[model samples]
Target: MLRFIKFAKDALLAFPLTLIFLPFSRFFSFLYYYNKLVIWIWKNKGDVTYHDFYSPFRDYKKRYALYENILQEQKLKEESICYLEFGVASGASFKWWLEHNTNIDSHFYGFDTFEGLPEKWGSFDKGAMSYKIPEIDDSRAKFFKGLFQETLNPFIQSHEVNITSSARRIFHMDADLYSATIFSLSQLFPYLKKGDLIMFDEFSVAMHEFKAFDEFVSNFYIKLRPIAAVNNFYQICFIVE
Candidate 1:
C-alpha cells in the first residue's frame, strides 16, 4: 500500500510536467508558423496590413472614438483640416476615420514605407517590406511613400498646410518602432497648436516611444496632456491646448 501511494504521487507530479512541456512545445511551434503567416501577408499586400496582424474588433473601437472625440472637442472650424497619420497599417484606421468623421473638407494624409521598415532599425526589428491595402479613394485622403524623414516635412511644405509655423492640425503616430515614432513626433511636434491632437498607437508596447516622449517633455517642458486613454494594454491619446 505504501509503495502504491508513493507511486501514485510521483505519477501525478510527472503528469503536470508532461502537460506543461507538451503545451510549451506546441506554443513555440505555433509562434513559428504565425510569424511565417505574417511575413507571407506582408509580401502579398505591401500597401495594406493583414487583419490577422492585430485584433480589429477589440483594438480599433477605442482608437476610433478617440479620433472622433478629439475632433469634436477641438471644434475645428475648417471645412477640412489637414490630418496626418504615420505608419498606417492596412489603411483600416484611415478608412474608419474618414467615414466616421465625414469632414468632407478635412484632408487625411498617411505616411508609410508601404514597403515596411527600413533596414538597420536602430533599436528594433524591421517590419516586412510590403502589404496590400484597398485604394483609398476619398477625395480628402492621400498616401505618401517612404520614411518620415524623407516624406513628411517636404509633403507638408508642398501642401502649404503650415499655418503660421505649424504644418497640420492633427497628427497620429503609429509607427511602432522607436526611431520612426520619435523622429516623426520631433519633426511635427513643433507644428502642433494649442488645440491640436496627436495619438500614439504604441505608447505602451514600444519602450523607446514612451522613453522618447518622456525625455522630450522633460527637456522642453511641453504641456501636452492625455485626453483619452484607451483603457487597454496599449495606445494613448494626447491633446495640446
Candidate 2:
C-alpha cells in the first residue's frame, strides 16, 4: 500500500513536467513539418501544379462563411450586382454564389487563365497549371479566360462607364502569389466603388501576400479596411470606398 502511494505521488509530480514539455515537443514537431513543407515547395517551385478552380475538398468552415456572407448581403439588397472571383478553381465558389444568390439580377463573373497560372509569374515563385478547368455556364455568369489584367481591363472599361451603369463589383482574389495579386488589384482599382468588397485568398501571409497588399495600398494610396477575417489566417474580406 505504501509503495502504491509513493508510485502515485511520483506519477502525479511528473504530470506537470510532461505538461510543460508537451507544448515544446508539439512546437518542434510543427517546426519540422514546416521546414519539410518549405523544402518540398522549393523543390517543386516551378513544376506544373494543379489548379481545380474549385476544389470540393476545401475547408468546409471557410465555404460556409462565404455562403453566409453572400446570403446576408443578398437579404440587405434586391439587386446587388455581381460577385466576381479571380481564381475560379473548379467553379466551387461560383456554384455556391449562384445557388445562394437568389436575387434575380445578381450574377457571378469568374476570371481565370483556364490554362492554370502563368509559367513564371513575377519574381517570387511560379503557379501550377496541372489541373484542367471544367465546363460551367449560366446566363448570369460570365467566365473570362487569360491573365487577370489582360481580360478584366477591357471588360470593366466597357461595362462600367455607362450612364445606366449597373456595374457594381465584389472581387475575390485567390491567385496566391504576389505578382498576380498586384496585377489584378491594379486593373480592378478603377472599378471599385464605396461598398465594393475584395476578398484576398492569400492575405497576411508572412512574406508573400502581406508584402503585396502593403505595396499596393502604398503605391495606389488606397484605404482598404478589413470587413471579415477568417480564423485560419488564410483569407481576408475587405471593402474600399
Considering summed lDDT, which 10 consecutive residues are worst modelled in model 1? 44-53
- Steric clash pairs (candidate 2): 49-128, 52-89, 52-90, 53-88, 53-89, 53-90, 54-89, 54-90
Model 1 residue runs over 4 Å out of place are 1-61, 71-79, 119-125, 162-168
User: lDDT of all predictions, in order shown?
Assistant: 0.64, 0.63
Q: What global local distance difference test value does model 2 have?
A: 0.63
Question: What tens digits encode model 2's per-residue C-alpha lDDT throughout 164-207?
Answer: 25645677887766677878888777666677777777664534
lDDT of 1 by residue, 156-175 (tens): 68875433334336677777
**Clash numbers, per candidate:** 13, 8
User: For model 2, where is the 10-residue window of minimal lDDT?
Assistant: 45-54
Error of 1 at 101 (Å): 2.1
Q: Each model's TM-score, in the order given? A: 0.65, 0.65
